[model samples]
Target: MDIIQDLEKRGLIQQTTDEEGLKNHLRNNQVTLYCGFDPTADSLHIGHLVPLIMLKRFQKAGHKPIALVGGGTGMIGDPSGRSTERSLNTTEVVKGYSEALRRQFNKILEVEENENSVVVRNNYEWLGQMTVIDFLRDAGKHFGINYMLAKESVSARIENGISFTEFSYMILQSLDFMKLYEEEDCTLQIGGSDQWGNITAGMELIRRSRENQDEDIKVYGLTVPLITKADGTKFGKTAGGAIWLDPEKTTPYEFYQFWINTDDRDVIKFIKYFTFLDENEIAELEEEVEKRPENRTAQKRLAEEMTKMVHDEQALEQAQKISRALFSGSLKQLSGSDIGQGFKDVPTYETAKEEIGLVDLLVNAKISSSKRQAREDIKNGAIYINGEREQEINYTIGADDRIEDRFTIIRRGKKKYFLIDFQ
Candidate 1:
């Protein structure tokens, strides 16, 4: 199947303008399509995955994919899919964010020296150079108050007090589409479902701007459904915060675990959504999910693919190793850095390096309520230091017990783990 049909089968399309015409356009020539991503934060989250993947899909399908970083529009935050107005960031912050997003997109999309590689453009290049009079005369003249009000973004925020800055975001995005269309011959724009308004506004801009000219301008807009979970909980959110693409923000282990722990009901859908595995391979995994749900074969593949794609192979290997060691209750093979990366979120405490008995050490680390409970836990074989079962309360934690003399892992039971950092 073609990339367009494949995306539809995966349930990626939510709305599109001129679908048949766009299909024919793709069939005839290598269409240039763009999707704008506002750098609202320093790093893109899991919510941005579909659009990013869509760009890759198009590039692999012998088309030019332009990733528009909204350096200009991001200054005045997008009001789409928001219940309230956004807290605008400074120009400096937005610049930093834009650069950060650019680096990330460089990794995700194959935008290197290849001819069909993706192109990264910042709208601020054109928008920043234009004067207010030029903007009002060229772009603003095309948008009427009634037409702008009708857009879903403006309509929803109209009652809740929308600002002119955000209300004008649609026009800025529309200008982006028009600029790309004029300069790069980019004829298509893709975004999330909420972007239907801005995207159509762009298509309209392209059409109206070229009306007086003899050139035939045909542009299209396509939107993908908002990423959501089957259980109705918000996707890409955890107790800590958003799952950041930056490994420093969210470790590869944590990122892998997020997909690995996908619900049984949602795993199949996510495999189709996230993985490049063909239908036969996915179908076989689906069968595994049915026959051996306990094995979590589908979830494992999903995690592996996602981790390796987002991070490097070395990072994926470390993540898998960490997960395996944790599952098997063995940290002896893992280094200090590996242990720290894997257990970054686990309960941690610090203590001066000294000769300490197992019972006293447990009390010091707060892994036990008191010396009495620590004694009971040790005698009952629940105390484990660096993967070694310490049944005797007299067991002393020495320099040898520490993992590379930096950290020590203490397991109170089969699952309860605590990291004691040595000073």
Candidate 2:
């Protein structure tokens, strides 16, 4: 069995109407598949990663992929898998988000201009062109009001009241799929388990559109499991919100830390979901989990591989450098960028332009409980500047302490760190 079959064996296929037929189709020729991304955020969260990973897997197995950015349907938010009507975003915001997300998508898949590579498209191209009359005459005729309401996505939100705009969302999505099928010859649609309703709507539209022609335009829908932690809390979300693919939204170090700190129970499953490690490599990591759990070999590798895949080699290297520096109690070699990325979690304080004593600033930043303690630490050589011990109690922290004219990393005692952002 190949990788797709292997994925199926591992229960990665949460729902597919015709799995055997799809497999047979793959056996014959390169299947053109698509997964749509709504421009809900500037960067995709971990929730979006599942289908992207599936698309990546399909691409690896010799298939073409269409990454559809929902520029049109985003205006009319999909009610499927939601309890409430989504707050609408402006067209300008959605357009900007779509472009940013496309760049991130390019990083994960083979999106180059080749036959088997990926192609990015926006539904707005067609949907925007269609007037209300055209939409109602051409696309709206195919969908029934009763059929739309019966969908769990719509029905679940009806009691609370759903807007007509959101109710029509599925029709637009179906149109997107049908348009791709007609123009791009895209044969399969993949999404999370929550998207079954939209996927089936597209499949049904294909059937109805060809009923008069006596032709069967078969399309398949595949969904991967919605990722959840064993603790029953959401995955890829922290108190800070979603761990984004874009480094600017969530820094490389923070992103690395998110995966590195995954619960021990979820590490193996995460490896399957997030990384491209082969079965044997995963098994070996599982063994390491048993023999030397404290080393956290699996989690670190998972973080490294994913961070490198999403960001770049430089971000991954910086994350690792900061991790090592923080862990080994040696941060002397860290640069200004390293300090900003590494110590982001630590508290920060801004000192006035006038010279201020280090001990007083430490107290002001709450690195020490009191000025007395701050003075004691400074006198005892427990304070550090750019990771070097500073013993002088009267040492004035000034322009000289600035790193690359951006930051000053202050160390209190041994492990605690605070960053002074030099404005």
Candidate 3:
């Protein structure tokens, strides 16, 4: 199937300027397409995956994909989806975020030395150098006040308030399209649903700039649907916070868990939106989801593919090991690193690495309320040390109880877990 058909099959295409024309444009030529990612944060989150993956889909179809990091426009901030004004980042901060995004795109997208390999660009390279007079005369002349105001991005914020800086963001983004079209022969721009106005505005600028020259401009825009959960809640978020792509921000294990715990109602849609699995494979997974929801086969596959794609095979294996160890309550098989990743959010206490009575340790770690309660928990066989029932009230926790001689796993009842860090 063609790229368009594949995207359609996956339910990825939300809005396209000219569906037929774009299908033909992609079919006939080695099209150069671009997607812009603003550096609003140091790391791109799971929400950014759809566009990033879309870029890969284009590249795989023998097209050049430009991953544009918004260094210039990021300073002004796009007002497309926000109800309030964005606090502008300093030059140094935007530049740092831009570089960070570039590095992340390099890892996520397939960057190579080949002709159709992904190319990374920063709008700051051009927008940063263009003088205000030149920008107003060349680009700003095409967009009338009414035209700018009519766009949903600006219109939605007019009631609440919109600043001139953000109001002019679309023009700056249009400059990016025009610049890329003139210099790189880029003919397509893709983004999330929120960017439709900006993308089309760029196309308009490209056409208007070449109107007097009598050149046929074929720029187009495409947007992926906004991901929504079956439940009323938002996607890519949990009680903790946003699910970041960076391992340091969200560990590989945590990332894996996020997908593994995909709601039954949203799992199938998520697999289609995120994974590159073929229709047949996806259909089979759908069957698995229907036949054996208890197995969570679909969720596991989604987590594996996502983990390996964002991280690596080794990271995926580690995440799986941690998951299994946690599920089975088999802490003995887990290494220190595995324990660290698996129990990262669990409560922890630190103390000297000396032998101590289990009851005293439980009280000190706050795992038990008092000596009496600690004794009761131990006597009732509700306390477990390193996944083993420790019914001995006088049991001493020492080197034998510590994992890697640095940490101990303490379990109260069935699920409450605590980490004891040895100094």
Most lDDT-accurate candidate: 3
TM-score comparison, 2 vs 3, better candidate: 3
Candidate 2 off by > 4 Å: 352-355, 376-384, 388-392, 398-401, 413-415
Runs in model 3 lying further than 4 Å from the true structure:
none
Tens-digit lDDT string for candidate 3 (1-423): 999999999999999999999999999999999999999999999999999999999999999999999999999999999999999889999999999899999999959999899999999999999999999999989999999999999999999999999999999999999999999999999999999999999999999888889688888999999999988888999988999999988999999999999988888898889989999999999999999999999999999999998999999999999888878888888998888788888999999999999999999999999999999999999998888889999999989888889889999999999999999
Candidates 1 and 3 compared: the better one by TM-score is 3
Instruction: List runs of model 1 lying over 4 Å from the truth.
Output: none
Error of 1 at 333 (Å): 0.7
lDDT (0 to 1) per candidate: 0.90, 0.85, 0.94
lDDT by residue (tens digit), candidate 2, 1-423:
775577765567888879788888888978899999999889888778878878888888888888999988887898877787789999899999889888878887747767688888999999989999988987789999999889888888989999999988888899988999999988899998888888999988888878889676769998888787999998888998889888777899999999999888999988988788888999999999989999999999999988888888998999999888888767767788888788767899876555678878888888888989998998888888877888888889887777766677888777788888767
- Every model's TM-score: 0.98, 0.93, 0.99
Candidate 1 per-residue C-alpha lDDT over 170-247 given as tens digits, one digit per residue, 9 for 90 to 100 = 999999999999899999999999999999999898888888999878888899988778889999999989999999
Query: Judged by lDDT relative to the true structure, which candidate is superior, 1 or 3?
Result: 3
Clashing pairs in 2: none
What does the lDDT come to for candidate 3?
Answer: 0.94
Provide the global lDDT of candidate 1 against the true structure.
Answer: 0.90
